[model samples]
Target: MAELKEARVPDIGDDKDVPVIELLVQPGDTVKKDQGLVTLESDKATMEVPAPFDGIVRELKVKIGDELSEGSVVALIEPAAAAPAGDAKPVAPPPQPSPASGGGSEVAAKAAIPATPAPATAAPTAAVVETPTRSPPVAFDADALMPGKVPHASPAVRLFARELGVDLAQLSGSARAGRITKEDVQAFVKAALAGGGAPRASGGGGGLDLIPWPKVDFAKFGAIESKPLSRIQKLSGANLARNWAMIPHVTQHDDADITEMEAFRKKGEENKDTKVTPLVFLIKAVVAALKKYPNFNASLDGDNLVLKQYFHIGIAVDTPDGLVVPVIRDADRKGLLELAKELGEISAKARDKKLSSADMQGGCFSISSLGGIGGTGFTPIINAPEVAILGVSRSAMKPVWNGKEFAPRLVLPMSLSYDHRVIDGAAAARFTAYLAQVLGDLRRLLL
Candidate 1:
């Protein structure tokens, strides 16, 4: 015999009249014990009300924006048959990829030089991939009547919506149970800017007064097919767009003579356990430079600059899903061999989609190496919070005058992109010059 029960909100401290922000389950959905039924948001934080027992949801008593107290009923549930033992183990969700603050590239652990950072290039297609995925419209209902209701969304999505000057109440979510996602907010902005939907609020954080993106019918001229961006691409695109628009970027280009450094690396490769790549050296060099120029290790915090005393370098790794940056904490303390080993481990984790949020945070500086893929020079974007990013290009042999005679020396191109507001032209020049000088001599890295 099945048992019928009511799932009610548990004691949520002294908070009262909390608004329902998300519905985690739909009617007829089977849920496990302690599974979230509905999400409630107060001023401080958001929390989920759980099911008292394993059961199937019968009905939802509340909707998005509905106010509920501690004793408020969330749903009617019917206890179901015990789940199979095989279902006891929980499966982990795939890791979502985040954007690096530079031209995106894969980090190769053992390559002679760092892999180059480049924009994601699309393969040749018959037509463009520009279709917008939208949810089915809701007919006249409670949502229609409550135009100013609070939206059912995550904190990150809410922040993104606010940045785009979007009123979430006016938008319909395309996610499960009508919950909103980053992609949903992006689609809404696209439609509004293309003159297909309501105009967004003016003077919002990201509300730039610009002409609408031109709508084109590519099929009218030739064969066409619609391809949507992957979840990683969509999310990364949003952040990149925001960073590009908000930051005043300037690129300082220079070349380092790495003839002796390369020879040393090659010599060290004879010992398999102590092998090192140019990137490991670059990490140490960057840390040394940051110690020399403390401003490079700081972030712009409104009116104040917050300088970080520790060294954690972000290395961008390309995965099948997208580019993700995993940070190497305390880079200043790690030796070349240790950094190389950790880089290998981090790169493997990134590709396997096993990187956690902590693996990507607390980076004071970032290095995007594009040495594997040949390029003379390119500008890398500054990842926000951090004010500067270093870009490494392929190294080439060039003739140099060594006082009396010309000699062929290996030269590596380096590009440093910084927030102009924080870094001046002369400072950037000196930083690059100092970095180049350090790279030119292997002994400088020891100091």
Candidate 2:
């Protein structure tokens, strides 16, 4: 007699009442041991609960959006007594939040580490690519895969891709008959990161299968003329979209007291040959902070972090055509006066549309200053191949508690946006504090 087994949620650490984003099987489906039964998403990560033993799913107790806790019954299954010997071996508990690579927490646009092996489903579908060269191979009936047909995927794979924000249509399926599988999506992300490109986003573009953009005449409401996007707009638009979609960005806002630094800049007004600006001072301060936090001067190359020893800072310049970032190479080596002079020259070249592509390359970090234009604060998108960017807003006078009394201080609003994959909240907060501290005390530059 076949024994009935209940597939239950395993011990997913501290993530109580996690939401189920996907259901991998339906009632009456014959499932194999260790097959993923559902995908649960907590605040930190997306996890899949797998079957405990080989069995037939007699009933499913949960649905999408249902909250689940550890040891919760997932589905009732009638265990197969004559199952293969391979199925009898005790299944290793799924990998935990690893100290080495928090593979458990990293999912979606920025996670570089390989996600825990999303268990395979018993359904006849696309073959899943195995990870670590040691996980069990995806096994089931061969007819589950049909060549020269539509790409095949289990329900689990679809949910996995959705969590990662990957457009399944854009990927070249790695399984037979061009089927898209969980492993395929993971591999696609790895390839995209290695190429310094992001997996195309779904909806309004590729994945998600969204509705086509409406092609209605606006003239019906009022007279209007269609203008083609400028060359720079067309180019920058695509890059901006890609960056926004792929990177998990978090912005940390702070205020830097540049009261002393401003006084120093005005003194240079007498020298017509070299006019110093607050931006020059900012560039220097930023370089000093980058030296303290080397990770800020690094890019995620595949699974590896590429840390550059040299500093090449990019300053965002608003030009007539569009926004352009001109690189200030060897910013660390340049003094405040030299940086100010170089800044003036490069900015002029940018506005004149004379900057070569090389002039914009090799930036380890970027600064987008809107001080002159005016803004309290803004989140700046990260320039990829670089992990972070600093947004500088207009400085204004604010009252500060001087321990003895309140004093009017010139405060510059600063926003630091970083890729959450490479930087955590605590580190970002510390970086912002350090930057503000340096800007507040110009003497720190001497160190």
Candidate 3:
């Protein structure tokens, strides 16, 4: 007798209610262990749920486009019966053809068919065998073809194809096993318009050719107009509002003179292969300062304050959609060059939407730099749970008093925003001052 078992969804990290995107199997299908059963898409990443054991799928409890949480029953499977005693592993039966094809009966009946007798007329002309005339191959029509069984492509590719009014079904996919690739879609769109099959429009070209100009009726809503927010946008808005309302934010401002640091960096760095950045110097300074003041490298946990011995700093990266913070683990231990390299790599990944949830979590402190955007000073919002955040602003040539006369020197503005509930105003100011001193000295960064 075979035992029935329920296949429950596995723990997909920290995300609880992940949405189910697709179902790979159906009822009564034989599945092997470790085979992908369903795809769960969270805000961070998409993960596949695999079969727990080798068995025949008896029933599927859920369908595609369903939202699933942890411990949700995905399917029911019946275990294959155990082989008797010392018998070898049971072999799977061969697949049967459709009943319309007459499967086993057609094969047996073919042998009993009598041969056709030749007619005896005027020497019978050697009984010419005529082959049936083949019909012309069907022209590729966009409406006639059905959607391919290949997995869906990225949303950007799909949107591009839609905007061009290019029917994906008409194009021959050149990806692995005929999957539709982004390059393939782009090439197809270019070729199709070039061939005069469709009219092409310039970037800002007027008339109906551009995006087919959607019809608008102004009389429908003359008084008011509103639109709903997307899921991601809605979540971001809520998070931002919560952070502003709940956290008691306090901002501290200071300036760093990079005169000695700039001179030191320019000394032998011209001939060296490795190029150094100001951000790298600042990161080293922040890590070193964290050692002296561990409270600055801490987070607020519930009513209790959690002080983290490990130094993980999150670098804020601004993308087209929204802001993302990718954490750099063990910043205190990493060298200046290593820290710069990791920061560049993680920031690029975050901008490209390739960062996982793990990369965003466990950040003890955060640094948001707007200096590159020509901002002299701006107070950055504190990333939630983190007690403090550092903001780097633009460096400018400002007048400084020398022993005899005033001279021009470069000055960098820095801002520190802290959770006032946990960190005092004086502590924030002192921390900012220390950071400014480190940036000014530069040699202490090496220590």
Best-fitting candidate, measured by TM-score? Answer: 2
The residue-by-residue lDDT of candidate 2 on 79-198, one tens digit each, is 744332233222222343244643331111121223443445532111112233233333432223221222356556766777776676577766765667788888877776566465
lDDT of 3 at 174: 70
The better-scoring model by lDDT among 2 and 3 is: 2
List TM-score per model, in order: 0.55, 0.67, 0.48
Candidate 1 C-alpha lDDT tens digits along 1-447 = 245689999999999999987777777666667877887878877788999986567789999999999899999887634222122112121122234323122111111111222235731110111321122453423232122235666666775776676777666788765778999888877776455856544434335544556789899999988988877778777767767877889999999999998998898898787558899889999998999999999998867999998999999787888778899999999888899999989999999989999999999999999998889999888877899999999999999999999999999999999999899999999999999999998688777
The full ranking of all candidates by TM-score, starting with the best, is 2, 1, 3
lDDT of each: 0.77, 0.76, 0.69
Pairwise TM-score winner, candidates 1 and 2: 2
List ranges where model 3 is wrong by over 4 Å.
1-234, 266-275
Provide the lDDT at 384 for model 3.
Answer: 84
Error of 2 at 438 (Å): 1.8
**Residue range 82-179, candidate 3, lDDT tens digits:** 21111212223312323443323221222111223335552221321122113344433211111223244444554455555555545566754455
Score residue 209 of candidate 3 by CA lDDT. Answer: 33
